[model samples]
Target: MARLPSGTAIELYESLDSTSLEAKRRAERGVAEPRWIVALAQTAGYGRRGRQWEQSIGDFAGTLLFAPEGASDNLGQLSFIVALALAQSLDEYLHEDQIRLKWPNDVMLNGAKCAGILLENLGQYLAIGIGVNLVNAPKGLAYPTTRLLDFIKDVPTPDSFCARLDHHFWALYRIWRQAGFGEIKERWLERAIGIGTEITVRLPNETLSGIFEGLDDSGALILRSDLGKRMITAGEVFFGPQP
Candidate 1:
């Protein structure tokens, strides 16, 4: 195994349903922070709003566990922090300006979804699950999907990719823990997609159409509509057309 820059420990698996579930189980058994669980393949995976993340062959699925100081009390914004870390890591392998953050936890490349993030709490620790489209992508998905090989041409192996992510994530997490979400907010805004564009937000209760203003420090999407400004913490955002 390649050594990570931040001395993070990695647990690699051949296959699993969800790395997040495995990481949470480890956390319950007293696993500490800076630990990662990576799987070469996943039989089942999940995305935002309980959507199933279709895992194709030769893709990347992993979960990074963190037990920050007072993590139980400051768990709300951890997901955004992890998203920010992924965005930065992706920048290294691709053009920096091509990677964009989509609200809560999605990384979009050139307006197509390239990666997704999911976070879960394990009482005392937090697990951030990430799935990157490396070699294969689901066909005819609702949203456009892309693979890293499509852009990188010669993509790295799963092990090398995870090691690089561990290094970049640790560096970003250090800044996040020290400076809070303010810094992340600014960076995310810089690479945000659909900002100032009219979009449809599908909420469980009702559908709202508004201009994508940006995100708040709490990682909520700030939408400006005829009814005035609204902060959305969770919802499905459709950019050009509704599906």
Candidate 2:
């Protein structure tokens, strides 16, 4: 029950295939900007790169739809903004330093992925989907996974965490809109993992191995390989010695 921006609309559902899909539907129907869609259970949830996202009964599955306005040029930066906000909310229940934000938008807790974020562009609008494993984290994933309840005895419900996330999201969003990515980049790097380490980035058609340099001004990952410096805009990253 936290305060949202003016003209913001909220839609709650007990179940949905995916909140991001619902938000896209609303955008197609010409719903106004700044709408939030939340679902207690998602039957067909998904994450970035079209990977399946498992939604526990009480986990948080929500999407925020908003007009790009003048931000279309640098819209991709919002993923980092959202990640920072989500990390801040989780920091309330978990140790702030324990939370690490992976490149792009994955939130890692104690080296395991605890949450994921997806951004979908819907023409006139954009939908940002957020999934947090509050009570349960699915097992047998490619990478290590974790749940909030594993560390915190008194875990926060989906809605309560969403409220806190909403507050932090808007606060960071406002700063991004006014001050630009300079501050956001600085803040994100503060919590970033694998800054100067050997890593591999799996692209759609090719794989790149390099030293994880850092992030470029536009948020692209800077990879320093024997060939030279390369800026990666999209790819899956793996830290440590590549297999």
Best by lDDT: 2
List clashing residue pairs in candidate 1. none
Candidate 2 lDDT over 1-243, as tens digits, reads 333454356677899999988887888888745867889998888888788999988888999898865558698999999999999999898789899999978999999999998998888898999999988989998899999999988988776677788889888988988899999999999999989988899998999999988899999999998999999998898998776
Q: Lowest lDDT 10-mer window, candidate 2?
A: 1-10
In candidate 1, which residue ranges exceed 4 Å CA deviation? 1-3, 70-74, 241-243
lDDT (C-alpha, whole model) for all candidates = 0.79, 0.88
After superposition, candidate 2 runs with Cα above 4 Å error: 1-7
TM-score of 1: 0.91
RMSD of every candidate to native, in Å, equals 2.0, 1.7
Clash statistics: count for each candidate: 0, 0
Model 1: lDDT of residue 193:
86
Clashing pairs in 2: none
